[model samples]
Target: MGNNNGRKGPGRREILKSAGAVTATAALMSAVRASFPGGAFAQAAGPETDKVTLGFIALTDAAPLIIAKEKKIFDKYGITGANVAKQASWGTTRDNIVLGSASGGIDGAHILTPLPYLMSLGTVTAENKPTPMYILARLNYQCQGISVSNEFKGLDAKADASPLKEAFAKKKAAGKEVKCAMTFPGGTHDVWIRYWLAAAGIDPDKDVSTIVVPPAQMVANMKVGNMDAFCVGEPWNDQLVHQNIGYTACTTGEVWKDHPEKTLGMRADWVDKNPKAAMAVLMAVMEAQQWCEKMENKAEMANIIGKRQWFNVPPADIIDRIKGDIDYGDGRTVKGSDLLMKFWNGGVSYPYQSHELWFLTENQRWGKLPMDLDTKAIIGKVNREDLWRSAAKNIGAAEADVPKTTSRGKETFFDGKVFDPADPKAYLASLQIKKVA
Candidate 1:
């Protein structure tokens, strides 16, 4: 997942039928007035922009883009002509936007968290100049899952749920260390999985080797024993379960409920130049976000995303967790958390400064960014809260939903003690096992 273009085998109609129920529910809810508070869409700002081009990477989290188009949210907001192209990968998504900024083709992108940070700091290609990009709003959260190959049955019975804990025990029994896979280095998937491992007393960098595989390649790598486990977004996790090659180890929701997973990214220059259009796009997507959060729309969204041209899997494969159902395939099946794809729950979707800083701190922890960089200045410049506020306001989002100020909440990862974002020095000092350069 995390915006992959891979496909697995087909699924059963019974699964599809359940999927249909989700679809029907979404369709019904789409027709209902948004029950949430204000009319974010009513008396919308007059037509300021007529055309737009958007990009996505073909994952379930791309639902906001798809639903907005399917439901004509863009048209509703006065943008008549829009292009939503599916990029090959997250890297490509960032590249396209960067190139578009230079060539005047791409406007904004559905991008990963590390993108703006890396780009702002000139960590990527040199040809691409600094394209100002900021967080519009969080698209969705807490849907990524860690899956273990079926061959690793011992993982299911490990004393701790953390894969790193199991990896340590398995290594003690054998001479070899376990292999864990993540999509990218200095990325959210890598950080979340690594934090989970370290919390269980396993050193991610020392106890096991972390490999970089495209989200699409995770299953194949696992099947070939190149990796013992992977943490990725869906429908890849669902694809693994459907293929009978792996079992769900733990969902990201278990680690941090409603954790920020994806966001709507725009070139900072684009936002500054086209503030009205930017706010309109956010409103349209927010409308879709509300639609997807409903129990009913899950199936239709799955069906659409499951097409070969998009996510390219069977609807059944993608429907379970989309509708809040979890299947570990270890004889464990549970309802998916409501926090599964929270578009706007408890100010969850709003980009918090502390949250952005968390990613920055993690980047430094892993040496993606220099250990001595001025992370606070970089984070403050890159995470554009002012832009997010305009878009949320345009959508009539409640003021209460927007936190007046960021909270450096005490956050404990899979590691034993909680972290104080305010005192990152202590937090970094507390780590016994770390990435040594």
Candidate 2:
């Protein structure tokens, strides 16, 4: 995230809300229609609730939610009272998600893909009390970056993380703590960095102390030498490279291409109580996703989300990376790489149950979840792909937009390890590094 150029303090945070759709005009509606010819959903029964409060972090993937609110897509879908608020950190997001809007928090949020499952099972919640949540949609995939301090710029780690193993070992040998940072403990950033380190034979759990830093604070903290390396979504990594504090070693997409990242998550009670309203939210976000996928809209999207009330960032830090232009900052720059973040990609938005299984398996591998846990049962309850399809149908989504099956098939990693969702045990057994058997 970009530095808050005079946009600091709590007052600006209070203004980080969606402009109500009440002021939407015919011109904007016509523009929205031009963006997606097939995206307009037929008028039906109005949403039960006109308003729904949601939360988002200062990350690029949160654009769908922001765009939905900013472009008045929520209003078009009959949710006139939609608001997307900025959250301080993933911890704050978790706390607010646990404390529903009725309790002065939020009803739903742009969350880490594994968070819904983690929150649902009480593993990541306080007092071990379950806060059931549903994964409504996969927000976006790939383009998140693993950035390293400029101290290792000469090493030119890039996609192969082997050089860092020796550097971290030497740092530890000097009796210094080798800290590797991520935004949240079982979130997408955590998984990406862990997988990258482990592929190079570095044990993320023992080789280095993994620390938690908020996405927005990554650049600031790194500038002060708070951490050696960090894994986070866009703008922060881009800012780090531009600030000369670090260079991006590689994007997480290099570890696993088109890998699932964040999700559109909501409280189960809220969805159950207001199913139609939830559908309205889904349709609006889905349409925004379509708007985000186009190449022409990227610049405008970056400018919109970079406003003071949203990410408080410059459009320069976001536009290039979002468009697949990566300046590694270590003398390597790739333009038009296939690793750009995908929003409404073909068959990409589906909330695949198999994707949830991979995260659950990884958490178990790292001892975050127990081996005996019934992950299948949890997935069945948390993954709402059925609702995704229903909303897609209601929105008149194209045939290419929806997947026939929930599984995206076997996924292969950079280490040549394959995770077959059908047989998670086989995949787990193949892993040489883990805290669990």
lDDT of 2 by residue, 266-299 (tens): 9999999877678778888988999999989999
lDDT of 1 at 365: 77
Candidate 2 C-alpha RMSD relative to the actual structure? 8.5
Task: List the candidate 1 regions with Cα displacement exceeding 4 Å.
Answer: 1-48, 101-105, 127-129, 157-178, 336-339
Q: What's the CA RMSD for each of the models?
A: 9.9, 8.5
Please give the CA lDDT of all the candidate structures.
Answer: 0.71, 0.87
Which candidate achieves the best TM-score against the true structure? 2
TM-score of 2: 0.90
lDDT of 1: 0.71
List, residue by residue over 1-437, the lDDT tens digit for candidate 1: 02223546434755675575475434323322232136433343343456778888666788888788877777666556767777776677777877774485577766667777787777764674666677777788778887877876655622245544654567747987578888776777898778777767677787778877777777778877788778888878878887788888777877775667777887777766655566667777777887787777778888877877767778887888887787776777788556365666567667777777777777877777788889778777777676666556656677767778766477765435556878887887887656634
Q: After superposition, how far is residue 333 of candidate 2 from its true place, in Å?
A: 0.7
Worst 10 residues of 2 by lDDT: 18-27
